[model samples]
Target: MANVLPSFPNAAPTARILHFHDSIEYESRIMYSRPVAKALAHPGHTENLGLGVATARFAESKAPDLHLSPHRDNGDPCVRVSMLSAVLTNKALLNTANSSLKEHYPENFKTRNACPLDMGDLDRLGRWHTRTVFTLGTPDTASIYQREISRLVSLHPYLMHAVLAMTAMHDRFLQSSDLPNFAQSTAIECYHHGCAAALFNAKLSSQIDPLDRNALWATAVLLSSMALFFVESSDPEELWPLAPPSPSHLEWLNMNQGLRVIWDIAEPISPGGLFHDLAQNPQYSYFQSKMTSEPQPGIDGIPYYFTTLYDLTPLSNARNNPYHAAVRTLASLLDVECTPFTMVKFLSFPSLMRPQFKALLKGKDARAMLLLAYWYAKVCESQWWIKTRAILECTAICMYLERYHSGDLRLMQMLEFPKARCRLLRSGTSRA
Candidate 1:
């Protein structure tokens, strides 16, 4: 009924098999694999079983050499089916088990010819994200996010696809060389499918329960991260030729705000939730203290000028000004994580800046433009991969400022301050 195993038009034997076991349901199926049918085709098995005509057809592909081994842990008869034949062509089994397999199977399928060091897709991706991607922007979210994903993946297809998509992109980004043609294609497919699934699920956004709300928020965070990567990889200048009223950065920020709305709605469900802890985490406090306190700049440290540059600005005492606050926050981000730059490039100054700040920049407010230029220079120095694009942005900001406020010597001086320091702050320099 449902073609669980992928069909090759050229009839080349498949090296992969999808082994599924619904422990709670005591149900299992191997797509297009004949060993299952042979195990079930024994004497007295037919009398106690619901053997339809499909079983007889499936038995045609049986291999006599195959044997059912007892499960090592449970002593249950374990079936190892080969995907070399057309046994699971029975629509009944396929339709019944399709959804279960897609959701519950962590890797979705097992490869028969996997080498000893070859971790399956889900396992490898999950570990990598836990280690790297979680800290790419907001840190300390990995454990809770990963736990919720694993817990809810069975009941939520949207979240499952989102995780898969993020993992694919993360893998692609980390690879030094080009991904194999097949892997490249598969990763692209995963991303699109995930986005589609997420959009489909959004239709029922109103009816999701508290538990599902957590899953939704988690999915939103993952989607936002994926989108960040998407925006970074696809040059924004090319995407927004005319620079629309609401740019991609604003769209990403709005998406993040949606997560905040979800968190507000779901807060009553668990007052001391993971998201709550993340918001009020001690690390955030430490980061703030590190920012507000005086800096002890070493020889190779971020220039002493950068540490106090925000305090010297006209907006320094304007504590309530979002643009001023954002500049200070970004300065701290650079100071805290400048050396051994890893995920710093993923930190988007635009994403952190409020709409009011963005409006100031768009309106050619000289001070805002100056601060933005400084931020971009720090961004450029943070990661080599993002350097060229960041430098282009910095150049664009400086050119725009020169066009509008070239007579303002102070603004020009402020713009140059961070750029000069960025030139000096080489990568791998020890933190102050």
Candidate 2:
């Protein structure tokens, strides 16, 4: 999978960095999810697709109706993948993997290194410094995640473990093949995270100052992204909903919800805290603004086909409708423009989904899946971590809904939009 990083995208960089009132820089991406099947022309964990502005114009074009193609009942989805990348290149990505990251994030490198580790662990830390850390957040928060958070590693050992664990998990995700090395790397990933979580939990049980609070918040963010990247299979059927239920099924959503726990406990709201900078980030503020401002009381912006599928009548509301919250949130997503800043609104759907809606999705409720599918299609190509998980899950949802719910014309009709949109996402890898 790491092999795909250097060559996949051929699209000219349509993404232009925008400056906010605060003069903060944010990058615009025409995102496509990483490869699963022929979804991306390259193999790897992140779908850093070069979907240029032209593709965005195409995304806005009316999609033709497409039926659900049959799902292959057998092997790994990526085994048949023959995508040849156009060599996805950007200034940051063009940097050699072995190059020093300190120059890019000079603020984060502490005078003292994380201690008591062998060279193997140190190598992983180096990889994080060079690549993994930079891609962890949006352009605005990337610095905070890479620079400010790294400085915290020395003061909070658990934060160091969390960073190592995330780096290891990223390495695990990048491998296209399932070798003995895959299992070994996975074990390493688990050990570091387990240690991080243990120490973190211990610290939370006691007193925490503003600095500890910031460290814990940053660690939680890393762990949360890791929790989502923990894949059961590259194939959708082999994953949850279709696969038997376990404690870990859709645990990413649970992890998403769990982030607030640390946030509430560690109110890193104190001035000068690292998280304070994160809180002030324009990307988040923009998302919260639209979320709070979108009018509700009905799924007004949601298409009639989806409204009918969910049984959301004129009289129905958040109190009685399971799909109410999810649909309402989806409407808010639709209400905004799909800018780099606004895409955060779409990616945040899982966290905002109500428990009843989440349960319906866990049960493979077709309506719920349709809603989720639409959300996935909208933002699948946007972020590295999201693209990490979105590739397979989005592909699976499209296939699953098409195969089983084919008879329901309304469901299939609504499904057409996401399916078509997802198709466009696949092509985004090479579009110029």
Candidate 3:
């Protein structure tokens, strides 16, 4: 202040401007604004931003109710949609992988061989390949948009509800628009629609009466039929009585009695007998046609099909009968170890011998005792000697006794012996 010098006001202002400009120029020299802005503007870069945001939101949301740990947040509709889409797409990927394996390694693709491949390695390869292929066609902007949408959905349940409601409404509108043509469809189409209607009605009926005995029985029968179909398709020989005795050989035999019972009860009430209805229905006509196209000849030149019954007892009882002779011939053809003489005697002699034996001993009832012994001997000698066959025979005998004698406890006890229990355990462990 003591050394005050005369100075123009404009001079001070100019100096200050110069100092500000120098600082600005220095800061500008080190900065790269254009490249940074371009990167932020780029589609791929934007997608990364969107993905990050979505992931963060998902991480913050509540877990879902499932057997496995929740894959995404409960509140995030975007995540749910993404996960569902992924699951669907994964199925397609699996199909592609299967096709590829079939094409390149046909022999290895068979059920026997395919069971042992390293699934983890295959999955990794499949994921990498699918991701690379998808990336090629996808635009960064679209990817970014999808990512952002997914994130938004993941965070908001209302958005998901709205989307689903809109979709359902649109579908209803389309369906209503086609109402005029619905009744004028062809017979086949009409039948298909009727079946669909029946199924829908059945579902509603089940929901209304959850514990309906008939409905439960129907479902059980349906499941059993499907199991039989799979078993039959895998090995047609199982359906034939000709198959040699093995641990696995008797499974169908064991199932036969239950299947018969199911058939007996459900057949009358069902639209028709299950197989008969299936054969007649146009929807299943193709499958029926395939089954009938190459009918296999059974014993006595009879064409074998699912519905055909081959009763050995009746055939064996008719002495000097052509069918009896045919049974022996069939046994020989099947390489089963059973003498025709023994088979004939077992069938015919037992019925004759038991009554006389019973009359002789009033206190012990010799006839019933003799019948039991004879039946046991016949079972031991027959082609159905396996554990499964024994179990099946036991079941069949139980059914016969129940139907004819109102459930004989003695016969039931005989069926549940320690020997049968041991056989069952052994059979359960052994495989074909």
Which candidate gets the maximum TM-score versus the true structure?
2
Candidate 3's C-alpha runs over 4 A off are 1-68, 71-77, 80-255, 268-276, 281-432
Per residue, candidate 3 scores C-alpha lDDT tens digits across 357-417 of: 3233222222233233224333332321122233333333333444454454544444344
Candidates, ranked, TM-score: 2, 1, 3
The better-scoring model by TM-score among 1 and 3 is: 1
For candidate 2, write residues 247-278 as lDDT tens digits: 55666776665554554545554466555655
lDDT of 1 by residue, 1-432 (tens): 121222212211212111100110111111102343333334233222211111111222222222223343253223323321222433333343233434322231222110111113333333433543454334445556655555555455555545555555555545524212212323223433333233323423233444555665566556545433433222233322223443333233344333333334344124434455555665544322321222222223333454353334432432344455555555556555443332422254543455677677666566776776666566654433234344544555665666667787766666675556543443222211
Q: What is the Cα-based lDDT of residue 318 in candidate 2?
A: 76
Enumerate residue pairs that collide in model 2.
Answer: 1-44, 1-176, 7-85, 7-87, 8-85, 31-381, 32-381
lDDT to native, each model: 0.40, 0.53, 0.28
Residue 388 lDDT (model 2):
37
Best by lDDT: 2
Candidate 2 matches the true fold with a TM-score of 0.64
Off by over 4 Å in 1: 1-98, 101-140, 176-197, 200-204, 232-250, 268-272, 275-322, 328-334, 338-352, 364-366, 376-407, 417-432
Q: Scored by Cα lDDT, where does model 1 land?
A: 0.40
TM-score list, all predictions? 0.51, 0.64, 0.20
For candidate 1, the 10 contiguous residues with the lowest summed lDDT are: 19-28
Question: Residue 5 in model 3: shift from native, Å?
Answer: 99
